[model samples]
Every structure is written in structure tokens, then in C-alpha cells.
Target: MKYIFFVLCWWLAGTLSAQQLKGRVLEAGKDGNVGLPGANVYWLGIPGGVATDVDGNFAIEKRPNGRLIISFVGYASDTLEIGEKDHYIEVVLKAGHQLDEAKVFKRGQTTIMNTKSPVIEQVITGEELCKAACCNLGESFTTNASVDVSYADAVTGAKQIQLLGLNGKYVQMMTENMPNFRGVSVLYGLNYVPGPWMSAISVSKGVGSVTNGYEAIAGQISVDYKKPQGSEKFYVNLYGSDEEMFEFNMNGSIHLNDKWSTALLVHGDWMEKEHSMHHNGFLDMPKKAQYNLMNRWAYKTDAWFVQFGGKFLDENRLGGQKGFREEMRHQIGEGNLYGISINTRRYEGFLKVGYLMPQYENTSMALLVNYTDHDQESYYGGYEYDARQRSLFMNYIYQSIFGNNPNQKFSAGASFNYDNYDEIFGDYKRTENGLVKNTPVNPQREERVGGVFFQYTGTFWTKLTLMAGLRYDYHNLAGGFVTPRFHIAYMPDEMTTLKFSGGKGRRYAAVLAENAYLLASGRSVNVAGQLLSGRPGALKNLDMEEAWNFGVLLNRKFLLFDRLLNINLDYYRTDFSHQVVADNETRPGMINFYNLDGDSYSNCYQVEIRYELIPRFDIMGAYRYNDARITYSAPEGLRRVRTPLQSRYKGLINLSYYTNMKKWQFDFTTQFNGPGRLPGGNQQFESFQLMNAQVTKFFRKWSIYAGCENIGDFTQKHPIIAADAPWSVDFDASRIWGPIHGRKFYVGLRFGFDRD
Candidate 1:
């Protein structure tokens, strides 16, 4: 049998190489030793534990009569005693509380949750993205409550996100772990990052971790930039807004000695003012300019690690009506107004490598590479969309530990993906009773995939945890597939926890580069079969979407009166089997794309809470619900409804405060939103409330801030559906829902210089 399966894989790699235990977990800052990325390293009666990466490193597996615990979350916990040749270590912790004679620090927790992860992660940080005016990553989830950002039409302002309730292209995004934005950059790619270049973001709800592939299904965000060796040798931010919008950012870092390092980042933003608020002559937002750049490099040693990076971007947009202009977009008849244009260019490069073997014991190996190029050109009034994309990705991993149980672990991988697309869509003019015709459609394609994966994880007695994974892929055009995943977590004490997960995901549906916001609406675009053919691997008759996600989570903590309270609950479900339906409601102008006939689904539910209510004051709350359905094709035929502009429940509340030598800070937020349907599903839309606030002041390195957004200005009075015809067919700017810009205000300034 293949030489007894190669001698049982060489006797399980010689019984997993025997013993191990490596470390790192620092914190003693003032710019000197930071690295505590998700702390928590255990061993006091071991049962598998680890969590540290992003420079805080870790590796575990040697236990023979314990004593090691190290913790985090506001710090102060540590212990060790391991000798017998202690295989590498470094611990450090220490910050805050020590009463009876001084020492009081406290200030951490701007969103974090990771009671030993088995997925169901959270982590937002960088102090919750500075409260507001995050200026990118599409406004960084204002006070986040499990993702949900909007604005997908009402004149080319494109922004979208939603998780568990779907969309955001089934959520996979990623940056530090590679695969980003994907195909034509998913409509503006969430404004192309740049929220001070993030220092954390990590979401992760369900179904993630087949070594990051198979497109997350409805979860997984991961960003975490800001580190070329822990950032800040200089930094700056300046912003302004009141609808005139403006921004600038800068970053810096450089080390070059203890094993190299480098970083550079820059960004610019502009908005050229023009707001039609509810007067609706369109243009409620758009008229933007952007430029971004990045550079990164790193190299570490003591068992090698290297990173490399490159990025560049350019963007411009201009929206319609309000006296359209962008050089009249190829005028041909009488004042050619009604304009909207978008132009974008992007390029990226990446590489990562890691190694650790040194003759093995807790072996390791890693490699990742990425490349992307995206281009877009758009017009929305006479309808024209253009796209281009080229992508490449690769992955390779190998980690070990099994027979000599480091609580059993394994990872094996191989992956490759490549995509090439060029698209163009129609109607340059086309008026019927008035003659003017030109129609186009050019689609091109290329896709390749190759995969292999295997994952396994286990832990037991010290409070469960188990995971399993599998993968197999081959797709020159939808020909092979197999993926499976599972997870489980349990804690049941130490203040509760529980989790469950399930997965399966698949992708390949760039349908006009993800709907290009339905071509800003005077619709007319349909495809029911031959799935866009300009030849070249014509997608073998479409169908490569597939889904399956399942989830459950629960976390708890409570200690009230003396502070400390946290609660969470989660539920998720997604089911599809195949999907690629766009269908703008049976027919209304038009927009159809097909490949699924029966049911589709989504179900989400959430509940959250956090409290600190006394010391530095904090509070949070959340609620969500969605039922999302699908099955369309109706003039009375296949029906199943709901899922049209989404919404059906959401709520939030937030508050924050600080004062006490930390120097003033305050924040507030509110939301309610609920009611939805809109899209020929018999009307339903109304229910609102939104508010925001912020303030800050600090010094030493500098800080100043201010903010406000939608403060009850609620707006949605007419989100474009035909406001006095613009080449009318009932001009439909994609039926948005709520907030078409209203209460504004913003201000900012920050400066830094931390690295020392």
C-alpha cells in the first residue's frame, strides 16, 4: 500500500520530534519593548494553549509538571518556573494596579475578546480606531457591532459590508494574511484601507482557517498593518470635514540594525464639495480624489522570517446631476450633462517567508506571495462599466506536532490561484423613440486554482477545543471541489464560553466585477445562460459560488458592582449550494444574472454587551437580527423574497469616557435602523435614528480630535429613484436606504514619534 504509506509518514515524523517550548511576550513600553499581541500562554496543568504571534511569538508542547501562566487584557499576571534546560523564553508583562502604595495604570480594551480563540474572535483596537472619522476602511465600522457598513448606490459612492447577513462578497478580505479585496477591488475596496494604516482589526466569526483560502463565506476580516518592527518613528494625520472633506496621513518607521526593518505609508483624500442633500439633483457625495502608497520590509532572525511589500493606488470619482461635469464625459448632443465617472488604478505585491526547523521539534515552514493589479473606469449615466484585474496568489505551509502531542496539532497546505479578467458592459447611448444606439458587451476570463489543505487541532481536559479541516480544489473551470471544516470550543467556567462552527465555501463569481453597483441604475443588463462569453474558459456554464456556514457562540463574564461585565451571543447560518443571482427584482428597467433556482438563505442574530461603567467609564450594547432569503424569478413564479436592501433590525449604543491624566476623551454613538424590504417586495422602509459624537485631547506626542456624523439627521428622503429623469427609464440609483449624508462635522490632528 504505497510502501505502507511511506512507513507511516516516517513514523509520524519521528514521533513529532519530541520536546518543545519557545516564547516571547513582552510589554514594558515607553517605546522599548512592546509585543503582547494577544498574550495568554498557558501550562499550569497544561491542556494545550498558545496565542501570541504578530511578534509576541510562542510555541508550546513541553509539559512535565507545569507552572507557566502568562496573561493579558490590561496586564499583570505572570509566573514561570520551568528549568531543566528551559527551551527559550522571554516573558515581560507588568502595567497597572498594585495599590497599598501606588502604581495604577489601566487603559486597554478598545474591543478585544479572545478567551483563547477557537475562532469567534474580535480585536478592533488602535483604541477602537480613534472613536470616529476613521477616514477609510470605509469608516472603520463606527463603533462596530459585528460589521455592517452601507452606501452602495445613490450615485457612485460605493461602500458595502455586511457579515453573517451576507454580502461584502462573503467576507474574506485580509491583509496581513494575504488575499485582499479581490477581483476589480470590490468596488473601491473599502476606500482602500488607510485608517492610520490600522494596527489591528481581526474580526473572525465563523468558518475561517483552512489556512486562509476558500473565501471565508461570511467572516474573517484581518488587517493589522502598522508594524515594520512596531511602527512610529514619525506619524501624522490631519483631517477636516463638514462635507468639504479633506485628509492626509503619513507614516514612518525604520530600524535597520537588529535585523532590518522599514516602513512608509502615505495617503491623501479630497472631496471637492457638492451636496444635494434631499433636493435630490443627485450628487450627495462623490467628487473625490485619492492617492495612496505603501512600502514595507522586514527581516528577523533566530530562525528567519522575512516580509516584503509594495502598493500604489490612484482614484478619482465624480457623481452625477448637480450640474454634471467631468468634461461632460464625451458629449455628443446638447449640453451632455448627467455625469458620473470613476477611474481607479491599483497595483500590489507581497511576499512572506518563514522558517524554523533547525533540525525539528515543533517544525515550521511558510511561504506566501501575492500580486494584484486592478483597473477600473466607470460611467453611470449612459451606462458603461469597464474592468481589468490580474491576480496571483500562492501559499505553502507546514507545521507539526502530533504523535508527541503538543495537544495534537497539524497544518499542511499548498495553494495557488490566478485570475485574469477584462470586462466591459454596454449602452453608450441607446434611446428608442429618439434614435441613438450603441451596445457593447465584452467579457473575458481566465481562472486557475490548485489546492490541498489539511488542518487539525485538538486540546482537551483544560476546557475543550477541537478543529478539523479539509480542502481539495482544481478548477480550470469548475471541475473539482471538496472542503469541509468544523470547530468546537468549550470552557464552562472561569466565566463561560462555548462555540461551534462549520464551513464550506467556494468562490468565482465576478459578475461584472461584483455588480459594479448595478451600473448606477437605468438598469438593462441581463444574462441567464452562456454566462458572459467573450470566450477563454467561458466558465463552463457558471456555477461556482457554493456556501455553507454555521455558527454559534456565547461568552460571558460578570462581576458587576466592582466592574467587569461582558456578554456576547452569536448565531449565523448561510446556506446556498450555488448562487450568483443579482436580479434587480423580476424586472424594472433590468439587471438579471442567474445560476441558482431554488432556495438560498442567511439567518443571523447577535447580542452583545460590555461595561466598565465606573473607572474610565465605558458602555456598549448591541442587537441585530436578519433573516435574509432569496429564491427569485417572479412575475408570479419562483418567489422566496426578503434580502433586498437588507436591514430588518439593528441597534447599538456606545459611550466611552476617560479623564485622569490620560487627558480627556469622550465618545457616544447610537443607531436603531430596522425595517427593510424595498425592491418590489411590497414596500417597507422607515425606521431610523443615528447619532454620533466624539472629542479628544491629549498631549505629549500630540492629539486633538472632534467628530459628529448623522446625528439624528437621519435622511433617506428620496435616495434617488427617479428625481426628474436623467436619461429616464425611471432612473434608479440602486434603491439605497437611509443616510444619504446629513449631519456632518469632523476635525482631527494627531502626531507621533514613539519608537525609541
Candidate 2:
């Protein structure tokens, strides 16, 4: 009966309908009435609405009340009641004196939109970022159900994310629409971005448009930093946790004039001590320090806008046995007390320039250029690896409409990518005869690609939207390939949307470097199958992975008891034509790398709901199921296997509450992590639950927050295998499935001065 009732509610939500009206706003003048820009237009009681473009035009859906409101600075506000016969109307605003502002309250800080977008995209605002101790990008997704973040390895404390049961590397990472964080930086790049510096985050799932690239097999994540012109004058965040972590971040803006502005962001963090809470003889977490700095400048005019920025990062990490000291780090091959050390430095710069066409307000041309230099040196026990990466990227895009119809538009772009990697690495294993030797397999390669793409988008009466895109790319090693993508969105009513997407993606694999953590164990690396020859200098001898992704989603929003409710259901499937499988199931102490000989696929299904139960209280819940598998070649022919450490089922619940005046805020989140088959012995781990809570008190210019993570204190009894024999061949740390450490508490403070 409960399930039937839930289905009935969903059916009713889709049946609600509304009328959409389009219009323009102009300023009253003595000479003539001119279009007014930057006007706020919306329904009387709705939370979301469109803002006027440069031409001062708006389109909005209206309820039965048929009331519309328009307001702007230095202009008198106007309210219009539309009759059944009237559909489109134009209004002129007159200059008038304004009174004092009125106090306002909001139910939610995070908003998800599905009005016209063919692909599922959600924007996480800075206000939502404050729900937790979000010191870095990896920690920022604690409250989001779409993405799952977890520790990559038990020893290094490195974090990785998953989308639709796929690894984070399959998701393209971008900054302000420019490609960033690729190649050698994929393992640790998620920690380089400080949360306080971000203005918003855009997460898009499924096959995206070819305008971005051909690498997005799972999704795309784009980070937008606070703009120099519209950001606060000064901001500071200080954070500390009971786990011996401390962090500080500060940013300030400087305006050269009305047309030019710049902002400087600085960050520093450190974990001062090593804690072995589990008594496993290994440190629970790595002790590390990181320093980051960035400077961004923006120039805006009526005809053009340009932004340029540069960033620098330096980080060091150390971990291993509890007794290992820094002085013994040099004794890599002869150490009884194992230790891990890593040092990294990265420098990046980017420029974005856009020009608006004189006659058309919605047409523009944009060019983006980015460069990065990254270097790393690390040692795990007896293994030593060093690498450097140099990359340059350039892209050009042109956006325009078909004739004068805004609903029909297209974007064409060309891009160039270059990456050079130089690496020196060796793995060592202890023998029964009391000897340790380095293993063979080291690669230094370079890759270059050039591509062009065109995308066409069409919208019909705010009811349907379609996007088609195609791109052709030429790789130095993989030869040439073409990728095609398509997306369609249909709205049956004002509250419901149905979307579908399909596309192909390809990527060059860096097997050894990407799986470097496995080298820390006793596992011996082996390569099988026919290797591509004559390309040792360039994109190594591995088969490039190609896959096709298909997705379907349904989303709806409705009003219940004068509060808003949102529900979403989605399913995604990925089939690989060619893939590199890192097999660790055949043997206990062996890791094999080879191209797939059979089939590889993943299917994911998810359902999510968000409801505003009271005036300032919101509840969000989600459930997900994943089936990911691959075929491996074994001594006994071929067999299908479950991908190690991939969860099959998961559930989440998040609650948020705030006071009437927004002075006090509280949030709680609980997650259920289902079991997964482990590598080596194919062990099936038990399911577990995790809980988190936070409280915040806000002042005029400052706010303080305190939070606790893993509040239930649930932890894996033995995350590491053979903890007592770290030097033995039976030791393996790559089979971790759950948290290594227990409950942790943190507190932080944020202070800022608004430019207004």
C-alpha cells in the first residue's frame, strides 16, 4: 500500500500543468523606451526564475494565479495579473525612490534545475558548501547523493570519487570550462582545490556534448571560482580537527577600476602527527603539509570580457609503520621499518577571452588556453618512483543562434591537447633467500591530440529540447577516431522532465602510474597479451579504451502543503569495446595488466527525493544499485568477474534545518554502504552504516561551525592484510573496503566582507 501511494504521488506530480508566457522589459525615457538589462523577473510565490539577458527578455512558467513580478535597482517594481486571453506582454519601468529592504527567508541553499537542459546538471552553491568542514574538493561532496567520495588507499590517504559505478578518472575535471587536472594529477588533484575559493560546482552525468571532449565516459565536473568583480572584498577560513589537522584559507579582491579587478587566494594545511588508532603497526593516516596560491584577473567591457589566472601548489606526505622516522626514509631497500614519502609541486596558468557580436546579444566567440607543469617524487617501502608532466591545452568556441530565433542555437569548437610525461620507477619484492631486487617495467611517453566539434541545440515552446554533437580527433598514437553524441529532453507538464543521452568516449591508459599504490604491497606486476610495438616513445604500448554510454532520467518537481518537493530517477549503462583490465583476482600476490579479451560493462540505477517538510527544514534521500563486471583471461580459459571494491547497493539520507532568521543551522547525514567482493580471495565484506552531523551559528560577518564524521564509530577490524608481517610476501594493503580510522570531530570558522 505504501509503495502504491508513493507511485500515485509521482503520477499526480507529473499531471500538474502550467502556462508559460514570454515578454520583455524596457526603461521609460523622454526620447524613447529602451530595453533594460539585469532586471529580475519571476512568479509571485515561486523560488526560481530566469533573469533578463543583455536584451532584457524573459520566459517563465506560471501557475493558476497568473501573477508576475518584475523589479530592478533604481526602478519602481511592477506586478501584473495575466488574463486567460493574454499570453505575452511588454512592460516599461519608471524611475522611483526605493524604501528599506524587507527581511526574507529561504528554505534551501541548494537548487537543482531541469527546465531545458538535455543533460542532467546540478549546481552546488557556496552556501551549500558550508554544511560540513569542506576543506578540499574531495570533502565537498559529503551532502550530495550523485557522487560518492572515498579513500583510494588505506596508507596514502588519497581520495577518489565515483559516478555511475565508474572511477573518477572517467569523469573529466574542468575549471571554468577549461580542461584541467588530467594525466599524472588524477590521483591527488581532488585535494588541490580549496572549498572556500569555489563559487559553485557543476556536476553533469551521462554522455555530455562533444564540445567538452571525447574523454567523459561517466560524467563531468566543473569548478567555478569566485569572480574578481563580484566576489567579497575579504574572506578568511580557519579550520581544525581532532585528527591533528589544521588549515587556513584567505582571499581578497582588488579593483583597479570599474573595468579591471583581481583576486588573490592563499591556502595552507598540515597534519602534524601520525596516529595509529587501530594498533595495526601502521599509521592510521599520513602526516602531510600543503601550500597553494592563486591569482586571477578579470577585465570586462561592453563588447568583450577576459579572464586570466595562475596557480602554484606544493605538498609533502609521509606515512607507514608507526616506528618509522624521517631520518630512515633514505634506506628504501634495507629498511626493517617501512616508510612512505611523497613530494609534489605543480604550476598552472590559464586565460579565457570572449567577444560578443555587436548586433546579436546571444552570440559570442570564446578562446581558452591552459598550461601546467607537474613534478612528483615518491617512495613506498622498497619501491621508488619519480615523474614529471608538462601539458598545454587550447580551445576555441563560437556560439550563435539560427536567424532571430533564440530557441535554435549551435556551438562549434576546435581544441588541441598536448601532454609529455617522463617517469623513472621500479618495484622491489623480498625473496625467500633474503634478497630484494627491482622489477622491470618503466615507461616515458608523450601524447598529442587535435580535435574539432559541432553541437546543435533546439528548443520548442519550452516543452522539448534536443542536442546533437559530433567530434573527430586525431591522436598521435591511436590514429584517428570520430565520436558522436545525442541528447533529448521532453516535458509532459511544467513539473516533469524526461531526458535521454547516448555517446561514445575514448581514452589512453596509463596503467602503471595510475595504479602506483599497488606497488606498495608484495604484489608482482605482470603484463599479458599482444603489445603494440614501435610506440615506446609516445603513447605507450597499451590498447586505448573505448566505450559507449547510454542513460535515461526522469525528474519532477511539485508543491505539497505549500512546500516544494523534487524526485529523480535515472539509469545508466556503459559497454566497453576495448579496455585495459587490472586483474588482481587470479593470484594472491600478483597484479596483472592486459587488454580485455571478452566483455566489460556496468549498469547503474538510482532514485533520489528532496522535500521541504517545514518552513526551514529539508529532507533528502537517495538509493542506488550498481552491477559492474569484466571478463578476465585466466589459466583455465576465460571467466566473468566482479570488479573489486565496487559496491552493489547504497542508500543515503540528509536532513537540514535552519532558524527563521538564518542564525542557527543544523545538518545530519547517514549513508548505508553495501557489501562488495574483494580482490585476491574474492572475499565478500559485510555492509556498514555511517552517520555525520554538524551545527552552525551565523553572525553579521562571521560564522562558526562544528561537525563530527563517522559518528557511529563503525570501522573495519583489519583493513590491511598481514599487518604483523609488513615485510613478508603475504602483506597486502590494496584490499581495503572501509574506513581505517574511527570517529572524528572538526570545527571551523568563516569570516568575510561583502562588496555590497
Candidate closest to the true structure, highest lDDT:
2
* After superposition, candidate 2 runs with Cα above 4 Å error: 1-13, 18-102, 332-335, 359-361, 429-433, 437-442, 529-540
lDDT of 1 by residue, 563-627 (tens): 45677877788899799888887877777888878999999988899887776677999999989
Residue-wise C-alpha lDDT for candidate 2, range 183-241, written one tens digit per residue: 77888888999999998888888778788889899898999998887677999999999
Backbone steric clashes in candidate 1, count = 0
Q: What are the models' TM-scores?
A: 0.34, 0.90
Clashing pairs in 2: none
